[model samples]
Target chain A: MDTHAAYKSRWLPWVLLLPSFVILLVFLYYPTIETFVLSLFQVAFLGLSKSFVGLENYKILFTDPDYRQIFKNTVVFAFFVVIFSMAVGLALSVLANQRVTGWRIYRLLLIWPYALSPAVAGVIFLFMFNPQSGIVNYLLEISLGVAPDWLTNPTLAMALLVFVAVWKNVGYNVVFYIAGLQNLPGEVLEAALIDGATPWQRFWRVTFPLLSPMTFFLLIINTIYAFFEAFPFVDLLTKGGPSNATNILIFNIYRDGFEYYKTGMAAAQSVILFIAVVFLTILQFRLGEGRVHYGG
Target chain B: MKRLVTVIGLSALLGFAFAAEKVQITFWHAFGGGRTAFIQRAVEDFNYTHPGIEVKVEYKGSYRDTLNAAILAAKQGNAPHIVQIFEVGSQLAIDSGIFVPIQDFVPAGLEFQLDDYIKPVANYYRIGGKFNSIPWNSSNPILYYNKDIFKKAGLDPNNPPKTYNEVVQACEKIIASKAAPKCITWPLHSWFVEQWIAEQGALLANNENGRAARATDVYINSEAMKRIMKWWKGLYDKGYYAYTGKPEDWDGANQLFVSKQAAMEITSTSDVTFMQNASFENGFELGTGFLPTADGVERNGTVVGGASLWLTKGHPQKEQEAALTFLLWFTNTENMVRWHKGTGYFPVLNTSVKVLEWQHWFERNPAYRAAFDQLLQSKANRATQGALIGPFPEVRTIIENMIQEIFQGKDLAKALAEADAKADQALKRYNASVKK
Candidate 1:
């Protein structure tokens, strides 16, 4: 009877998990496996005829300078986006947590950018930074006596893209940070304050340490978001433009796959990107284990 | 009593069986807005005239999107009976082997009087002396200028810039007079670029812009192209031009023109309706002119920019016949005249032009005659023929990138050379893959 009961309990958990398991297998694993298979062959709109060209697509991707530059650009874009987003999100969350007047309104205004679609945000940025007639340039010229071609300048274009990405995404991180801040034990902060710790001292020594788990979570999530989610803005605003300065890995993958119809090459590039993201994520987790505090 | 009831039922069934089969043919097109209404009207008329057949038309987004969707669907065995592929995609569609030749559907030995079609327009759809698809709603790029802006800039409103030098001079005057922020605007489209190259009688690609056959090489970095790029670069350097950055940013340029902020704009003749309907603050009148030419170079004809109706394979003989009948009706003279008058597209049938002339429509709307006259007067040269590159959409993106580079102050010659190298590599790969 006990063995039967144990078996029933074991099957019950699986039965409860069955729906999610099937959903993941169908939606995620199936497409991933198909994409992997497609990567081994040359596919087009005409028809799919597979011929074994083992590692040939990978060779082409690795040998191409454009792909290398695109990889570097993507890494750079992601790094800047994550760093800027975390900094801004943390600051905004901390400020909102303070018992200031109308703090809720400020918080609402701060996180409002997260509500915008990336494509719409990209258009708004494009108009705001347009060289000829953008409001940003107009303001800059009138106040600072300088108006640079923000989109046309290769050096500034990527920076502008990172700025836009952070502006649009930092609000999402702020929500996470605010939750982390609110969930913190009040006794720990009160104890630190009673022990002659100042506000900055308490934040740096106690509060920041307690928020390490949240910081780690935000880091991983923001990195992935920067890698994949920020690509549409780059496509819409710059089109990997100003002499391919803004071309990132996923954008290059899209250009090669859909626009150029170089399916195998794009798949190979995607595999590379996947491997890189996995490696970075593992490294982040490994590094954060020593620093992250799970409890007060 | 049973026998009497059975006899009555059998007679009723026989009477119902004698009724015609409701033939349904699916037509996928990229037409929307006013053009969609015109096509819907044509479908309604065709259905009314032919009691047995019903044509179902579906709007499938832009020309490129429609072609991509149809090609994908054809591979999956779900393609429509008829698809409206753009002119550039015609070669790709023909090479794909999924479409049934229109000539094959028509009765054998029944000459369709192919000579009735305008030579250049019909020749575009012809592959080795056999027409592949029926050309419909064809248009060419033309210059659209604001007369009020021209007057303010001290330029002749009637006689717009004819030569490239004159265009530059007029742009400068317009800018200097503060009539417009930028004197002129050109939408960044490959078709328009090809048209400009053809206007200078420069070959865009080998093999007669690939009309003779499929192109394996791109001549985008030729001397004439370099010259044109240099001229555009000069204009950009002088602040007489502005790049909208987005390929679909013609709305901004149109707004600029309508607001009397831009003196001149070059776009498709199809944009005539949009320009005509735009509410202008200063009440500007539009001036239509032929595309400008370089000094001492005659203007070559602009290539067709609209979509054509393609018949897909894998349909019953009756359905095929019904599709062909629909195509014939869609391109008939009266239908063509109605389509042309309704949309800004020039009628594909010469008889439709004659009919319009008889009706005094062209006399009342003289601006609409500019594209027709320009096309008719153009010499049938290889340069003026359209590009038929296999991976043309990809090639266009590459060219757009090169243009962006130029806008960023890259050396035009070097940039074009690099772009040419990349495009040739792409062409070679595309040609090899498409090879039987």
Candidate 2:
């Protein structure tokens, strides 16, 4: 008996893949290649005037202190958002996994923020966190007797962004973790229980190891989301200001390209961002996947 | 069923015939919120009267976004017939080589005299004695204060601050009396800095504020700039000035004032109507004053702070002609008065000013007169004509960031020096990139 399953015609596979291939080519590959090409040239008048500048744009990017600060800011932002969102999500998922009354409603409420676009979330949070008139400051002043400037202070602004980002993404991580919890083998948990393991030990030794695959998956997803999807939040809320404290790579790209009309420089920055994210993802897969216990 | 099909086909054919006869042109603009509706209504009115031409107007985000979109569209050979560009983008628009100077069509004749436009506004857009763009919605900064707060602070409500020192003194009184949490606020913007620099009769860049030739240098560290920064920084240090901590946050500054968080604000003259309504709703008597100059300065006035209309290249002759007609009509005396009534923007035409004077419009609404007086009193000089830099948008951000750094306790001299260096570099790069 042949183990191989084959299509009747080779054209069928090509036909089936054509739509997605065309989309990827048009939207992704073509722009990526064009950006790389444009990165090597000095562009003006929306590329009506141009000169080949080799790696001059890249040289400027790497040497600029502002760009370096932006890189550091992005890394710190992504790290906080990923770590906190996943940690809170896991803790909530573990608690919510219990067979409690109205568990469905609890889960539904927890997942609602994931439905809002990042821009909308930014607008809502911007209003709530306004230093002078916001409800957040009002409550804080009344309760704590000290209202910190949430937007003007650099550290507070970064913290606020991280906090809002985590809040926005925690629901998404919870959805995944809840599914991962449902798939956990009951026998192993029961065995751990019978062996006199504490609740914490059960989570750490058995359940955690079993959920490594899901955690690893969410790690990659969260990292990418924190890197790229935070543009709208930055634009709507901070505009990457308060002394460039919140300026991230994506918002900087937009400011340079669209606002400043430095298209070549923005393209160079894009290429750098693209490389950084790709390398980061690849690094994660290489070091992370080997430890993920997929078989349970 | 056959009769219904015939009726539908006949109507569709008629619709196509009617559309084919109309000379349709697209106009892209940067006005949002209430202004978008006003422009749409104006376009509808224009379309109703001019059955031969159809003007399709689009609100394309902010000033920066609209300019970028226009350039990108023009690159793809689909440029809008008319693009509204803000004051800062004027140099870039002229450098883009994408627009046909409105002056080229001047000989075709406008019913209204071009000289009737306000001098400062006309001066700003008239590059090398040629009208590069049609000035529209011109404005300058004016001081807005709450009379209730002034009265509470034991300061005269009719007499607002007239100089930087006086503003500071008034703020001190207001804060000391607990009339407001903060004394004053303004959008931490570069435009105000430009205005202050102009007020001192100082140029912002070399070569006559970049009017005589392409600007290759910026005077960010000039004495005028340092003086302005020193005064501004002093306010922030004294805890008298409040801001939303975001750059160019005009609406945020307005919010602080209307909510009584701040006693006074310096914002665009274009906000007169909004300020009136806000004062009424908030139950405060509003007072408008000239933008305060530095103490002991002669007060050479402010540059225009609003957008203008530019005609794009590559449109058909008929469309270009139609766009020119629409622009002239939009800026005509009657429409100028209507625009001034609808929004607080200056009626750029002298005839419109006469009409308003004839109607005693200023007597009924004195706040609108403050801005117009400020503009009319501005000296005709290089400084008051405003700076022209190819990379002005970038230079503006750099200055805003520098000011933010200063607010965060950066050394004023060091920050200004660094900003100067950066602005000059930007100018050099911009000059290199764009061919004259």
Candidate 3:
């Protein structure tokens, strides 16, 4: 409570945390502010000269239908990835919770998809779905007597991307869900069973309600992953292809930034994406607050 | 005790004072697999001949990756002495001011024999009559076909597709015969599309395909492009052609061709060795031809696609001299012939070609001469000179996406028009930023 005593404690903590704070400020905050500033100017390769455009880049982004489509695709991708991953993850977690044979192996198998890099996963999917040589087509031809070009069809391409995203991410989500489910009190479930509740009733009234926090966490993380981390797959597999069906926001950013060298436009798109993600996250938190149950 | 202490101290001091004998120069390349091994061998040969200079060659991913890494490293003052940059990045590298022009090091008027190099290859690196970089590995697109499938389909294996219509007919025959599911597999590279346009005597960009000046606008939605797109769409509709997903999916396409799933493939000449080697197991003979033309139009030329060696700035005088020496040695007649034979890339220097001819290497292997013939047959026209747009890499992606959309049954004209407009906007942005 004395001035010297308070200063000693405060100064000690500040000194201990200085290096980390400096790193965050230099790497994260500095680049973020610099990007915002760069967004207002026209930047070029081979030179440091930049001229202020003052909202012109943003105007172009707004007027351009390509950017609008990319924005929509990104949002839609994030939505489907979050919802489906959570649904599949929750279902798998509940299934694994049952005292069944080989559940450990099932759990391990579920998590294995997460270990493969997205680029490798994209290549594997490409081969598996190749119209001529792929097993998918072989089975389709054998069973249905018809095979469709999955990568070349616009609708099917979008669906394939969403399927790959869920496939790659659901495992990680299941791991989190299992941890959450295992932490729930056994007595509470036993009480429900003693009350003569059916399995569906117990899950709907107790287990599902208790898993909300885990669901919320998975929702945020999966949404971000779908938005950013899925770009590599798009780059490698579809390349935002089949007529821009799979061209999400991050892929557009990469194309504009590195491929096109349109840094200002890319920066503008990035800012918009950042704001969109922030808004969605806030909305998720606001809606989740009413639904998520935290068991003390 | 004092005498033993003095003897031990002398040896310790001597060991600590002596520095390593070699001066290590980092060389960043885009080569991988067998080509990477070839480059490593070349570096080892250089190291063996020149004991003082130890070249440490590192594969910094692909062409795009190496350029990006080099640019970033230059900003951080840690760039490699020599960086391998793809042709698309030539202008960007030249404009960066981070590279020391090869012309600057080689004595002026001393006759590095600029004329001895292939015209187009030399022209790619020359800006305002000064060489910006040295052409290391050069390749052009050519048609590769599965001869077994051709023969199986009752088509002449010796006579490959010469026109667009013939290509389609051949595809239909292959498909009808059930010899191959798809008649051909096209790699999704915009450069290929550009080459196709040029080969038909059409321009994809203004200013003679940007050879005379920097391209500020795109003219890709022209009649020639539309015709090519229509042909492509027809092939796709008939299930005659298959898309290989990405530009680097040549290996997948090669596998499909070798496995008898596809009858034809048109890829870089650099893939010749791979095709030949893979054909051994399948017992399918490999056939090579020039890319097909549209209607009665004669084949103008195909543009080159490969990486060149760039000398980055900020090295000491001795280091610059060392880099110059390495470049000279690497591009010398003997080394160039060795590189050309080892890898499928055509030698950039005339002397190397002559040396190969003198050695009767070409006579022994006639299939390896198609790329050289195509390059020589090409006239010095604006259409065949290649594009030098500021945002070419990005523009290429847009064009590729447009083609993909067309393949997915989108209206070809509308897609191309939209791509053209978007590319124009991108070009404007690029121009506005770079304009003096």
Best by lDDT: 2
Candidate 1 lDDT by residue in tens digits, A183-227: 999999999989999999999998899999999999999988988
Off by over 4 Å in 2: A1-6, B1-15
Candidate 1 lDDT tens digits, B1-436: 9999999999988866654467889999998777788788889988899988889999999786787778788878888899998877776787677898786666554345455678768766776667788888788878888888889888899989877788899988888889888887775556667787877787777887787777778998887787677777777788776655555466655655666556787877877767766634457788889888767766666676787888999988898888888888788888888877777788877788789889998778767877778888777777666777778877787787787778777777788988898889888866765663
Q: What is the per-residue lDDT of model 3 for residues A194-258, given as tens digits with 9 covering 90 to 100?
A: 99999999999998888889888888998889877998778877878766777899998887776
Off by over 4 Å in 1: A1-21, A145-147, B1-20, B107-114, B279-282
Q: Write the per-residue lDDT of candidate 2 for residues B1-436, one digit (tens) a residue.
A: 9999999999999999999999998999988898899999989999999999999999999888899899999999999999999988889998889998888786444634677887998899899888889989889999999999999999999999999999999998999999999999999899999999999999999999999998889999989998899999999999899887767878889999999999999999999999999999999999999999998889998998899999999888898888888888878899999999999999998999999999999999999988889999999999999999989988988999899889889998999999999999989988999863
TM-score of every prediction relative to native = 0.92, 0.97, 0.94
lDDT of 2 by residue, A1-296 (tens): 54334767758889989999999999999999999999998888668788889999999888888888998999999999999999999999998888999999999989999999888898889888887888998999999988887878899889988999999999999999999999999999999999999999999999999999999999999998998888888887888988789999989998888888888999999998899889989999999868988872
* B-chain TM-score, candidate 3: 0.93
What would the TM-score be for candidate 3 when compared with the true structure?
A: 0.94
Q: Candidate 3, which segments miss by more than 4 Å at Cα?
A: A1-8, B1-24, B108-110, B246-248
Candidate 2 TM-score versus the reference: 0.97
Provide per-model DockQ scores.
Answer: 0.37, 0.70, 0.54
DockQ class, candidate 2:
medium
